[model samples]
Target: MNENFQAILLNVLPLLAIIVIAYFAMIRPQQKRNQKQNALINNLQKGDRVITVGGIHGTVKSTGAQTITLMVGRNQELTFDKLAIRDKRPS
Candidate 1:
């Protein structure tokens, strides 16, 4: 009976270690990036240059609860979701 329990534990140990390693290597960094993105979206303001995930670049014209108005060109403005923004552009 004891030998059977030991065999089961031996089989489970490696699986548990793999799960832990996967969380640290993959899941944790993704979670951190999500948090940073959320913070950036929340802190968005007018006139901030930003790039979208689709590679569109624009200056922020206005901000709303879930959307942003971007001035993409002369006399051209477009609205996009806050989550669509990838990162701010360097000045």
Candidate 2:
């Protein structure tokens, strides 16, 4: 029983180390990116040029309570959820 428990602990230790490494290498950066994206979306206003999650690029035409209107090109308009905006205007 003692040997079995020791072997299991050895195997679990490496897995736990891998999980920690993965979290720092992959998960942490992704979370930071998500937070930044959320901040950008929350601060959106009219006249801001934005890129959507679906890859559409447009200028914010109007803002509603839960939706936003985007003008993709000349005379082309679209509406999407506020959360779907991926980025704001370039400097």
Candidate 3:
């Protein structure tokens, strides 16, 4: 009985360790990044400079529930989904 229990524990222990390690090494960091991105998206404001996921850099002109308008050039304003924003640029 002791040997049988020990064999089961040995087999399960490695899998449990792998899961815990993966959560800390991979999942936790990704989740933190996602939370920070979400916070940035939620707090967007006009006049803030931001870059799009597609590499377009612009100043925010307007914000909506699901979209934002950006002035990319002197007379070029583009509208995009809120999710398209990648990161805010420093003033």
Candidate 4:
């Protein structure tokens, strides 16, 4: 009985340690990045220049609850989902 219990504990301990290390190494950082992206999407404002994940570059013209309008070119306005924004650019 004692030997069986010790063997089980030894096997389980490494699995538990791997789970903890994986969480900190992969899961936690990904979650923080997602939160930061969500905050940026939610706080968008007009006149901000941004690039999309699709590589579109434009200046914000207006914002809606789920969508945003951008001025891409001369009289060229495009609409995209808020999540489409990848990063803001410095003017």
CA RMSD of each candidate after superposition:
1.2, 2.8, 1.0, 1.2
lDDT of 1: 0.96
- Count of clashes, each model: 0, 0, 0, 0
**What tens-digit string does per-residue lDDT give for candidate 3 at 1-91?**
9999999999999999999999999999999999999999999999999999999999999999999999999989999999999999998
Q: Write the per-residue lDDT of candidate 1 for residues 1-91, one digit (tens) a residue.
A: 9999999999999999999999999999999999999999998888999999999999999999899999999999999999999999875
- In model 3, residue pairs whose N, Cα or C atoms come closer than 3 Å (at least 3 residues apart or on different chains), thus clashing, are none
Instruction: Give the TM-score comparing model 2 with the true structure, all chains together.
Output: 0.72
Q: Pairing residues by index, what is the TM-score of model 4?
A: 0.91
- Per-residue alpha-carbon lDDT of candidate 2 for residues 1-91, written as tens digits (9 for 90 to 100): 9999999999999999999999999999999998998788778888999999899999999988789999998899999999898888683
Cα displacement (angstroms), candidate 3, residue 14, comes to: 0.4
Sort the predicted structures by lDDT, highest score first: 3, 1, 4, 2
User: CA lDDT of 77 in candidate 3?
Assistant: 98
Tens-digit lDDT track of model 4 for 3-90: 9999999999999999999999999999999999999888788999999999999999999999999999999999999999999898
Q: Is candidate 1 or candidate 4 better by TM-score?
A: 4
Better of 3 and 4 by lDDT: 3
lDDT of each: 0.96, 0.91, 0.98, 0.95
TM-score of each: 0.91, 0.72, 0.93, 0.91
- 69 Cα displacement, candidate 3 (Å): 0.6
